[model samples]
Target: MEIEIATIGGYEEVGRQMTAVRAGDDIVVFDMGLNLSKVLIHDDVRTEQMHSLDLIDMGAIPDDRVMSDLQGDVKAIVPTHGHLDHIGAISKLAHRYDAPIVAAPFTIELVKDEIQDENKFNTENDLVTMEAGETMPIGDSGELDLEFVNVTHSIIDAINPVLHTPEGAVVYGLDKRMDHTPVIGDPIDMDRFREIGREGEGVLCYIEDCTNANKKGRTPSESVARDRLKDVMYSLEDYDGGIVATTFSSHIARVKSLVEFARDIGRKPILLGRSMEKYSGAASRMDGVDFPDVEMYGRRQGIERTFQRIMNEGKGNFLPVVTGHQGEPRAMLTRMGRAETPYELDEGDKVIFSATVIPEPTNEGQRYQSENLLGMQGARIYDDVHVSGHLSREGHYQMLQALQPQNVIPAHQNMKGFSGYVELAGNQGYKLGRDLHVTTNGNVIQLVEE
Candidate 1:
């Protein structure tokens, strides 16, 4: 059997992540995602109504035209998680593929919502739900199989999909940290990973996320963030002013902590904003999720009414957990900053941001503008009460020791971001352009020629 890897999108930058692996006559696509920063850079751009080619030309979504060069049938389109960077382009480009979109339950539900909400393309790929620690056959070849290994990240129900081929296993490792004690889901399966490294022909190719490659030390666990959040909220128990909390809507674990701690501080917690409703609503309905039932409003009228009620009842009595941690223009917190909403920020009111600014110029500018607007209104900002979801240098060192793959690919980052990881891999004795591939989009690397 022959083996080949296509370095599609997400090779040069961190956002649009798409990779295809060909083992013999079967090909499996991993993460047909969108470069969300590309989309956000253009104001008033409604991507749901846009065409695939236009979005590709805008550098918003993956340019999968390179898929035509591969000589294999796509067996499955695997999205590792529900984050927009991983699954955002499913509705845009999935209609072009004949493969089924296979993912975990939460990711599948998110994909279904995206497809249903799409305005232009009618994407009708078969939705297959596979849980973590499960395996399914891929294509007619009995030698090929697909497995989902549980992994811990900011989002719930995240997994790393592994393609088992005749040569060896291809581990699609992205968007995870070495979290052994996540608040909501199971721990990162290091035992299974170590087992896989020693099993069969060993790992043939190990593709990894290098988002925090330049950062030193280990990425702290979600449990660590949870403790820090609890301490912060508990210390604010005596203050009687308005307290507004914000985080990633997709980060269900952090939201859960906010809700529980708000109640602990004797305040009613209300989940506001569109994405807060969408993500928390879907997550609470899923089985095995430890999310609590809380009041949420997504629609404009409903959110307005809720804010009015919060103001009427007294700001000290309610804790509003809204969106806009990164200060997206249309998000609830940004609207509040601009005073476009009814919720008023007083002189001593608190705004707790449980997220850090994404290391992009567009996000930094928007966040700065939003914070300035809030500061002008005399809102006391409590920022960066969060931890990253990607591995740092020590975590990368640990992964290489565990997997010990024959070939490695650094992904989910730009060339500058890949530099730290490149030096790290070199220290581990992997050479560039030989086994450790530093590649770009729309390129192909042949591992085993027929």
Candidate 2:
């Protein structure tokens, strides 16, 4: 049996992520995501209509490197979560493999929404939905076995992948934080992780998410954000003008918190922007998390109506949850900057950003422009009033010690983060590139019986 791993994208950099894992003759791909920086800022691949294939052909990201050698042997395409950086490239890239795509239910729902938004139907590939604790048998190859182990991340339905092989079991603990107090899902399945680590013979390698591999301390729970948001909303309630709160659309738990907060302070929750509607619709439709019979104006007209309502009913009567935490120009906040909405920012008005900067040049500039515009309108702006979803270095070390896998690999990191993983692996006495593999995008590493 042979094993290989490659970081097709999101290796040298942080987005347009694609990763391939091969065990013997069977192949699996995790996270065919778009490089948000490239698509939004650099290449300007605006709109959902932009096909990943077109981007691939244009050399936007390395496509062939991820697709090669898996024409018919592809068994599954799995995403760790619903984040666009993890699943955005799947419908566009994975459809060609003719394999079943598996993910947690919420992730699948979000991907479906994304596909429909782009007006492209991807019914060619089989879609299998599995919850956090379940294992589904995949592939005709005799030596391959796969399982999805639920874990905590920014968005819900995050999983750590396990591939069982004759040589041993390989765990992809990709893009996770050990948030026992995750707002939306069950706590980390530590018992299962320990059992898998103990039972697997070779357990040749463990590839983990290194998004926050360099940071120290455990990531705070989503509940912290909820409490802080509650306080901010209450404080803003003192103002009579429009109060707007923006966050990542996929942050269902955060949205839920906002809904509850609005209810607490006697304000209705009004969702704005196409993304807010899409994700909220998915959560209600699939996950059974319904927001109160709050008024929802869907899309273009919906946002305009929201602005009008704020003008008439007073912004203090409602909480407007919107997109554009990253200051993407087309998002609700940016459009507000352009004065497309009827409701204008006024003195004592509140604009709450419940997210952090993604650290891209365009994002920084857009955020600066948006903040300035809001400030000019005499709005009180709140920034970085949020916690991260990724596990920090100490969190990574804790999980590593908890699972105690035989080998360690760091994934979902750029070169600097990967170097940090190498240092940790060295401290653990794991040899780099052997037991501790630092894989690049599109490159594959195999596990062989020792």
Candidate 3:
């Protein structure tokens, strides 16, 4: 039996995520996605509307080599969660292979919306939705098995994909935060993670998310973000105008908290933009999570109408949750700044950003321009009132202590980022280029009997 793992994208770079695991003739791929920050900045398009699949032809699609390996033997293409960085490229590239695209329920909803919006992708291959904590067969080949283990991130139902191979089990812990106190979903299923680790004979190799591999300490919980937002909201009860809060739509946990906070202030929540509708709708339809019923409107005309109603009724009567927390020029906030909509921001109005700047230069510039414009208009702006989804260096050490896998591979990060993990792994007795491997995209590492 032979097993090989390759990173198609998101190795030395940040997005366009694809990883392939090939065992014999069968192969399973994870996360066919696009480099969103690059695509958005280079094309000068709004992040959300960057959906036109035509961009793939323009060489915007990240490396598809991972998928090409199983050109015919591809049994499954799974994205661990709904974040665009994981699933965004599937609709654009899945047709190249015949495998089914498997995902969690809410993630499937987001993908369906993408397909519907584009009116593209006509294929009969199965689009499977699996529940968290369930084990599933990858193919009839009998050499490969894949399972989804529930994990916490900014989004609800995020998962860590575990691959069971003849050599041993390899866990792909991508885009996770070891938050034991996630606000919307069950805590990291430590029991299941351990069980899988044990069943796989102590896990031959572990590929983990090193996105925040350099930061210190465990990531704060969603509850922390909620408390921060609550504090910001409580300070503004004396003034009554418009209250607008924007965050990652995939952040169902944060969204839930924001909705509850608005309810506490006696304000009905109003969602605007295509993403707000898509994510909230997906979460509501999922079995376990439920978003409070609210008015979801879109398009400048629709938002303008809702704003007029809210204004005439009473600014204190509603909370407007729109997109553009990243300050994307075409998002609702920028449109509001440009006065393209009928709604106006009064001096006492509040705009709260429950998200951190993602650190991309373009995002920073757009955010700067948008915030300056909003400040000039006298709208109170609150920024970065939230926690991150990725685990930091300290958190990574903790995870290593917990799993204690025999082999460690630092993934999803650049050279310097991988160096940090190498240092941590080294102190723990794992050697560089040996027991601990820092790999590049497309470089395969094989695990063998010790």
Candidate 4:
């Protein structure tokens, strides 16, 4: 049996996560994503005129040139979730291969939206939607079986795909945490993981998320973030000014909590921005969450109209949940801060950042500018009322104990992020570069039977 794994992107950095798994004659790709930090810096006019290769060269998308020789052998392009870092580059890259794109319904909808908006590729490619716990056969001969294991994360319908090859099974685990009390989805499928570990030659290799491995304990649940938001919002019930909150648009659970809280406090809940409309619509369509009474604004014109309505109806009577928690210049929160919206920020108005800065230089600068603009308007700022979605050190430890794979590979992070996984695996008796692999981008590791 011959199996090789290639780290195309997201090994040396935190974005553009793409991995290729070659089992014998068939090859499968997981996650064709983008590096948002690089993508956001490009001028819109220049990026629209640039080709995919140029974008790859500019570090906006994953560099998949290594798969040039094996393009015909590729069977599927699978995305784990709806986050831009996991599904953003699909419209630019999926047309190059003959394989179909397989993902959960929510992710598929987001990708379709991306394709419709970008029109980057004009090719006809098949899109296959697979829900959690379902298994599908890949390749013309059906030589490999791909299964999606349900997992809890910031985004709804996130999954860990397990590929069953002739040699053994390999699990691609990324962007998930074991949240037993998730607000929107079911708990992480730990029992299925144990079943995979104990059955059928067991797991050959486990490539896992290391983004939050440096943290000491388990990552907090989305429910915990709900409680935090409650604590912050409930304290301002009598404030006579506007209350605006910003968070990741893909976080359906957090959005649900915010909407519910706004209603509980007798404030009209309104969602602003195109992304908030897209993600919230997707979630409602998937039956992942219900927001029957919340109002939504999807365009700049609509947002401005809603802002004017809010100003007329008294700003204190409305709760606006917009995008730009990361201080994106085009997002609603930033536009509001720049005084481009109809509703003005009063001297004591509240601006709540429900998301954490991603710790990149670009994000830091953007957040600083946004905060400065808000401060100039005399708005009271509340930041970092959020919880991470990646697995921490203890979460990694629990996953290792449950899976108990023969070989371990740390993924979805740079060297600094991989360090915690290295230490945790070391404690479990997996030596470095032997049973445990700490690989970089463009490196390949082969697993063969003894």
lDDT of 4 by residue, 231-308 (tens): 998998888689999999999998988898888888989999999999998888778789896788898889999999
Between which residue pairs do clashes occur in model 1?
none
- Scanning candidate 4 in windows of ten residues, the lowest lDDT window is 41-50
lDDT of 3: 0.76
Model 2 C-alpha lDDT per residue in residues 246-312, reported as the tens digit of each score: 8888888888888888777788888888778877788888754777696665678767876886888
For model 3, residues 393-431, the per-residue Cα lDDT tens digits are 777887777677888877767787777777777888999
Return whichever of 1 and 3 wins on lDDT. 1
Instruction: Quote the positional error of residue 102 for candidate 1 in Å.
Output: 0.7
What tens-digit string does per-residue lDDT give for candidate 1 at 322-403? Answer: 9888888888999999999889998988999999988877888989998999999889998899999999999999989999
List, in order, the clash count of every candidate structure: 0, 15, 0, 0
Q: 55, model 2: CA deviation in Å? A: 1.2
Pick the lDDT winner. Answer: 1
The TM-score that candidate 2 achieves is 0.93
Candidate 1 has a TM-score of 0.98
Root-mean-square deviation of Cα positions for candidate 3 versus the true structure, in angstroms: 2.7
Q: What pairs collide in candidate 4? A: none
Residue 211, candidate 2: Cα error in Å is 1.5
Report the Cα lDDT for candidate 2. Answer: 0.75
Against the unseen true structure, what C-alpha lDDT does each candidate score? Answer: 0.91, 0.75, 0.76, 0.87
Superposed model 2: Cα runs more than 4 Å off: 42-44, 51-53, 57-62, 69-72, 119-123
Q: Ten residues in a row with the worst lDDT in model 3?
A: 45-54
